[model samples]
Target: MKKEGCCLYYSRKSPMDDVPEEMTPIWSCTNEKCNGWMRDNFVLSVQPRCGQCDSLMEKSERLLPVLTNTSPNQKKN
Candidate 1:
C-alpha cells in the first residue's frame, strides 16, 4: 500500500496538455452572446449559418489542431 499523504510526485508533462495547433480558417457566429464556431473548409455551405443560434457567421481564423477532414460533404469536385 502507498502512503497517500506522503506522496511527492511531480509530473513533467500535464495530462491536459494542449494539442499541436495552427492558424486555421473558420466561421464564427456574429451573435455577441453565442460561442458558435466551425472550421471553414469542413462545412457544406458556401457561407454557413450558426447551428446553435441560427445567426450570421463570418470568416475568421483560430489556432486549432491541424486536422484532415475526410468527410465526403467537404470535398470539392
Candidate 2:
C-alpha cells in the first residue's frame, strides 16, 4: 500500500517516442482560423485541399514517422 502524500508520479511515454521519424512533406490549410494539416503522402492528388474548410493547403515539412501506405496493390502475406 502507498501513502497519500508519498506517492510517486510517472509520466507515460508518448506514442511516437519509439517510432522512427523523419522530415516529410506536409500540407496545412491557408485559412487563418483553420487548424487543418495532412501528410503529403496521404493525399490523393499532388495539390490537396483542406478537408475541413475546402481551402487550398500550403506545402511544408515536419518531423513525423512514416504513416502513409507506400504500396496500395501489394498483397499482405
Candidate 3:
C-alpha cells in the first residue's frame, strides 16, 4: 500500500506512468494567520481550518482518480 501526507510542497512528475500525476489533488490557502489547509487524501478525518483568518479553507483544484485505498487481495498483474 502507499500513502501521502499534507505539505505545502509537491513535485512535478511526467504523466507517462499509470499513476498519472494528474491524480494528485493540490490545495493552497492564503490565510496567513491560520495554517488552514490540507489535502483531501490526508488520513486525518478532521479538516483543517484557517487560524488567522477564521475562515474555511478551500480546495484549489480537482485531480482525477482520488486514490482512497488499496487491497491486499488484488491481482498484481
The top-ranked prediction according to lDDT is: 1
- Worst 10-residue stretch by lDDT in candidate 3? 68-77
**lDDT tens per residue, model 3, 1-77:** 87987778565864545564454553445665555554455523244445456565666655554465454533322
Please rank every candidate by TM-score, starting with the best: 1, 2, 3
**Candidate 3 residue spans exceeding 4 A from truth:** 1-20, 32-37, 50-55, 62-77
Model 3 CA lDDT for position 38: 45
Worst 10 residues of 2 by lDDT: 68-77
What is the Cα-based TM-score of model 3? Answer: 0.30
Q: Assess candidate 2 and give its lDDT.
A: 0.83
- Of the two candidates 1 and 3, the one with more favorable lDDT, higher being better, is 1
lDDT, model 3: 0.52
Each model's lDDT: 0.86, 0.83, 0.52
Candidate 2: stretches off by over 4 Å:
1-15, 71-77
Local accuracy of candidate 2 as per-residue lDDT tens digits, 5-25 = 767878686666678889998
